[model samples]
Target: MKLLKTAAVFICLTATGCSSLNHEPSSSSPSTRSAASSEKSWWPFGGKKTAPETAAKIDEAATHAWLDAYEPRLREALKDSKFTLERRDNVLIVTAPVDSSFNPDRPGMLMPTTLGPFSRVAKLVEGDSKTGVLVLGHADTSGQAPVNRQLSQERAQAVAAIFRLSGLRRDRLLLKGVGSDMPRAANDSREGRALNRRVEIVLTPQHTLMALLAQYNTPAKAGPVLAVTQTK
Candidate 1:
């Protein structure tokens, strides 16, 4: 299944004109590019320039490699649960229904079954020191904003405590409770409300060798520069 998915991704990238082997000439000299990069904002990944085509391929390949190592283990661990796992903007997002987390409207009491899933999540985070955890609690629009907000905050704290006990470092954990402000679905329907009342645990790298993979894959602000205007 992994191989099939990978092949499909390759095909999709090719169809969308994102082939790794494609090449384009640089518009400016190395020295000129260097000067421009210096004036740009600083990043941990530094401002080293590579040909756009090559950089795109590197970015795509690196991201694929990363998923290969991370996603499968998570899938195996949480196969029995009705949770959602996905990667977005260079982070792994795991969402669990609030029902699975604790008793209805009870933030202080964590359900016993929730411990296994939380442990698995902790193991994943523990294996990678570069990664950080962000736990966000959300709710449906069933009550006053302030009440919901406090409830969400309490739930987030409870979950973060479990993660810390499960072996994640305290400094690497971030907690937030947005309440009903960020809903996954419309709260009018039962199904939507269920989806909206959830917790999103995000695992992201604090620092990595290629932290700018997304940026490298992005198109330059100047587009494919056909001409470089020189100042006298």
Candidate 2:
């Protein structure tokens, strides 16, 4: 049974029988950071993008104003979807599905950024909102730790590429490959391992966004009182 679970996680191939989707990673996002040299390629899904200068140059308070308005609207875009949102404190946990097909290496592994979620992310940046950091993580359990780590990070890059299509400044997003250092579930079990393979999107602090909101909320100071004129 566990073996079947293992096979199931290999949806890219085993998917002949099962549907073209796997719902894992809702458990815990896997994030791993490692350094390795690899050839760089242009994003296939959509062309690279950059945020407007106005969006880029702003304080946290002002950005937050944009965020305050953008967040709710963004939520609406993601409503009733597979991507789950778990917000704690100021961080937003986006457990969005990625299309494993978009992965770079094809023969051995199947990693693609799920299209649905990617589209949603693009919408956020396309709008007139504050810019911030976007960290991408790929979670997988196929190859050994070292290889899987690289794969996970590559998978993350794939998602970031899709976001780049939306036209946000590449600088606003810090693209890295976190090979599966972080696991949401146990790797011992097939189901656990599948759950481990995922992309964890954390909305790290975007001081620009915050500052924008502050200025937006700060009310204008009252003007000084005028001197009374004598009518008599």
lDDT by residue for model 2 over 81-194, one digit each (tens)?
666665433344466544334333352233333455555766576453344544444555567656665555555554555455566564455443344444566678877766
Clash count for each candidate, listed in order shown:
0, 42
Looking at candidate 2, the ten consecutive residues that score lowest on lDDT are 223-232
Instruction: State each model's CA lDDT, in order.
Output: 0.55, 0.43
Q: Tell me the tens digit of each residue's lDDT in model 1 across 1-232.
A: 6545533443343233322221213453323433343233112112333322322222445545665678777777777876778765445678888887766654545665566676677777876786666676687889876667656655666666656555676545655555676677778999988887888776655442223322322334222111111100
> Per-residue lDDT for 95 in model 2?
63
Estimate TM-scores for all models.
0.61, 0.53
The residue pairs in collision within model 1 are none
**Which portions of model 2 miss their true places by more than 4 Å?**
1-70, 98-113, 140-142, 208-232
Best by TM-score: 1
